[model samples]
Target: MKFDTIIIGGGLSGMTCAAMLAKNGQKVALVTAGQSCLHFNSGSIELLGFQEGKVVERPFEGIAQLNEAHPYRKIKTEKLAVYAEEARTLLAEAGLKMKGNAEKNHFRLSPIGTTIPAWLTLEDLITLETTAELNGKKLLLANVEGFLDWPTAYLSDSLSAMGANVKTASFTTEALAFARKSPTEMRAINIAKYLDKAQNIADAAREINRLGKGFDLVLLPAVLGLAHDNVDLLRKAVETPVECVATMPPSVSGIRIENKLRGFLGQHGAVVLNSDTVNNGFFEGDKLTAITTEKLEETRLEANQYVLGTGSFLSGGLVSDYQTITEPALHLEVEAHESRTQWTSEYLFDEQPYMAFGVKTTDDFHPMKDGKAVTNLYAIGSVLSGNSGIKQATGTGVSMLTAIAVAHNILNQ
Candidate 1:
């Protein structure tokens, strides 16, 4: 098999890069190993939420202050602004409706009800320029009866503290009740599956409408829109204005984004190999010639260029043994500490060194092998070492901007 470009890992970065290239008429192929971190998203894309222990009001300004090794530094601050808009446009083209921009960061209500800085928030979620916006408003917090993931109490308390007239309600349909029979399967995704039907959506809407009378806004757990935008249907059914708060994974909103983007890739003629893993890379001299997957053993999949967006340790992009950490796919050079003891911090909340550990890359985002840059292989997203997405709150931004930058590099070349 051959393609213009082959991207390993179909997470945010890989998908973004594939989508951009495919849209521009490049024959692209993407291989993904099941689930992505999008399952844990909060319905928002954060660009540098916190910098130097402070919330960043403007993402570009905060990105400018990032360290030399941070992925954002590779593109430089000025180009990031251009790519930021392009990323947003690409996502919009993929059917994601979002609010906010790269220049200014808005605040999205977290699962626990605290506000977090975000570059773009899904349209169905609540975003505020300031906490004062929540003051003096009538709000209703609604959740599924058996769903334990939604923190009703925390959300109510946080909203009330912001001076909002808060009320809580629980509503469930027959399908939702049926799903609750199995405790282990009673997750957000399961609830969303049951609630996706027409009758279930209408039943839930009726209950919410009854409880949401005279309320300024009705907030429900983000359990709608997994396979489709059922939230829109629910909103149309209920008379009151309705919105969703992000719930614990598997995030319905994130999954929706992934599905939309993946669908877009297919629509644009891109081959997507889901639930497949890249097991080996065939390299010659300083270039990666082809790769093989677990499913397609011995059948070499060749491409002119390759993208490694396999993600960090959590996603199995990079692995750590007793002696050292290494990039598993191609044995690419990684940036990490030698001693295992130095990989972590004493405090759980403190900065951990391992999170910043990933494949070392050049200014153009090419992965290195034996201290030499791989001519046709580029690493993007969390796979590149330097900044910790968890600590810096730049995960989504890095995944997106780096992917866009790499796509441009491939297209121009």
Candidate 2:
């Protein structure tokens, strides 16, 4: 099939780019072998959580000091500012409203009651300046009947030690009848789906009213809703403010955002083909003309522009073997140490050198081969080298920013 742009990998980066490009009037197709990492995320967009072993208060300031080779540096400061604002607007319009901004990072409580700095968090999350803020607040945690992803009692105890009036209340089996009716024990996603229905949410809200009386705020597990914004519905039903704490994956929050993006892009006419991996690229001189997929080897997907966002080793953009590491698709040049021993630090908690390994690219995000740029083909997200998304807590940020940059570059062309 012919198109203006073909994005390999339907992960966050690829989908973000696809949506932007399609909105800008480019015909886009996104291909992926499996589900995106969004399903495994904590629903928070973390940007530069740590700097030189120190916690960062402001991520925008942190980006200024990033090494020249880091991916964020490629987009330039002015463009990054525009991209950040645009990304926030797009996400909010897609129905996954987020809080926080570029001025500073906000702290959100984790499942263990510890706070972590995040650039953008869902509006349903209770953000705090410090653990001390929880002190004296009448906080009630609503634990689902069989959800074991987080220990409510332990978290409540931890909060209590910090001077907060924390208490735990369980949603009895009858209250969670919607979840208990499932063939298997309810997971985060299942609970979220059940809560998506207005009737089920109203019923649960009534139950919360009975069990969560006199609390300043009711805290529920992240399974607030999946199909729609149930946070508002549930909040209105109970006539009290509600917040969701982070839980283990399949993250309901992440799925909600992913589904919203998918629906938004679908409405804009972008074709998303999952379970299809790009196997090889056909190049004419320095520009890629077409790509072949694993499922459809005989068919070539032709496009004027291509984006390689297959992600790092975790997503199979770069492959590591006993002898060497390689970028299998198009055999793009990978940036890494010559030996495996140098890939990691001696200390486990210290920065791992291997985390920064991926395809080396130019400022324009075109993959580099033997010190020359590969024309017409752009690389973004975890696939780009010179920065550690995991170490810096910049995975989603890097992916979204780079995707926006790539889309703008393509549009400008």
Question: Which candidate wins on lDDT?
Answer: 1
Question: RMSD for each model, in Å, please?
Answer: 1.5, 1.8
TM-score list, all predictions:
0.96, 0.95
Model 1: which residue pairs collide? none
Identify the runs in model 2 with alpha carbons over 4 angstroms from their true place. 173-175, 181-183
Clashes in each model (backbone N, CA, C under 3 Å)? 0, 0
Q: Which runs of model 1 end up more than 4 angstroms from their true locations?
A: none
Model 2: lowest-lDDT 10 consecutive positions: 172-181
Q: Tell me the deviation in Å of residue 70 in model 1.
A: 0.7
Tens-digit per-residue lDDT, 295-398, candidate 1: 99999999999999999988999888888999988899999999999999999998889999999999999988988999999999999999799888899989
Model 2 shows how many backbone clashes? 0
lDDT per model, in order?
Answer: 0.90, 0.85
